[model samples]
Target: MWYQVFLWALFSSMFVHIIAALIAFCRLRKHKIGAAVAGLYRAADFEMMPFYALVWGVGQSIIVSFVSFTRILATL
Candidate 1:
């Protein structure tokens, strides 16, 4: 279950990141010089995706645990 949660969080964050990148790229592409500059920065940005995924997954796990604990408490 924890593994599944981790995968879900990772994939969801990645999906969101990709969509955001596409939007930013499209907007930046209007100017050749700007796009080139953004492309350079985006390379470094992409490299941090795994770190983003890890943080997102851990946050999600914490929320899930909190909710589960609350439910158990309510039942008692």
Candidate 2:
């Protein structure tokens, strides 16, 4: 059960990160040189990445746990 929770968190965080990167990349590609330079700086903005990942991971994990708990209760 704990392993399942861990995996859920891991996958959720990874998915969020991948989607964010793709979105950032797309935005960067769509812009002019100045915007592209700014985008490069944004892409290298590591300060918020970990916080975002942690928030998403924990949020997903909480949702998963709540759903599983309710399912267990229903089975009882």
Candidate 3:
């Protein structure tokens, strides 16, 4: 059933996008990694810290929110 679930178009697309974004966010940061990677801009300078804003303190929340919405719509 889990394998069958992975085959759906919606799941595949959203998962691909999520994975890509996560990779990108990781590449952009050096000191810490968290939900905020989504929001990082070129202007930002690296400042190593122990923690980050939770639940997408970075720009990632927007992408995650969109993906979540799509999942909800697909279930309907």
Top lDDT prediction, candidate number: 1
lDDT accuracy of residue 33 in candidate 2: 92
Residue-wise lDDT of candidate 3 within 9-75, one digit each (tens)? 7788999999999988776665364336534642376554536545436559788788797897677
Score each candidate by Cα lDDT: 0.87, 0.86, 0.68
**Top candidate (TM-score):** 1
Of the two candidates 1 and 2, the one with more favorable TM-score, higher being better, is 1
Q: How many backbone clashes does candidate 1 have?
A: 0
Per-model TM-score, in order, reads: 0.41, 0.41, 0.31
As a whole number from 0 to 100, the lDDT of residue 73 in candidate 1 is: 69
Q: In model 3, how large is the Cα lDDT of residue 36?
A: 62
lDDT of 1 by residue, 14-70 (tens): 999999999988887798889787698798675656888799799999999998978
Which pairs of residues collide in model 1? none
RMSD of each: 12.2, 11.7, 10.1
Between candidates 1 and 3, the lDDT winner? 1
Residue 28 of model 2 has an lDDT of 75
Greater-TM-score candidate between 1 and 3: 1
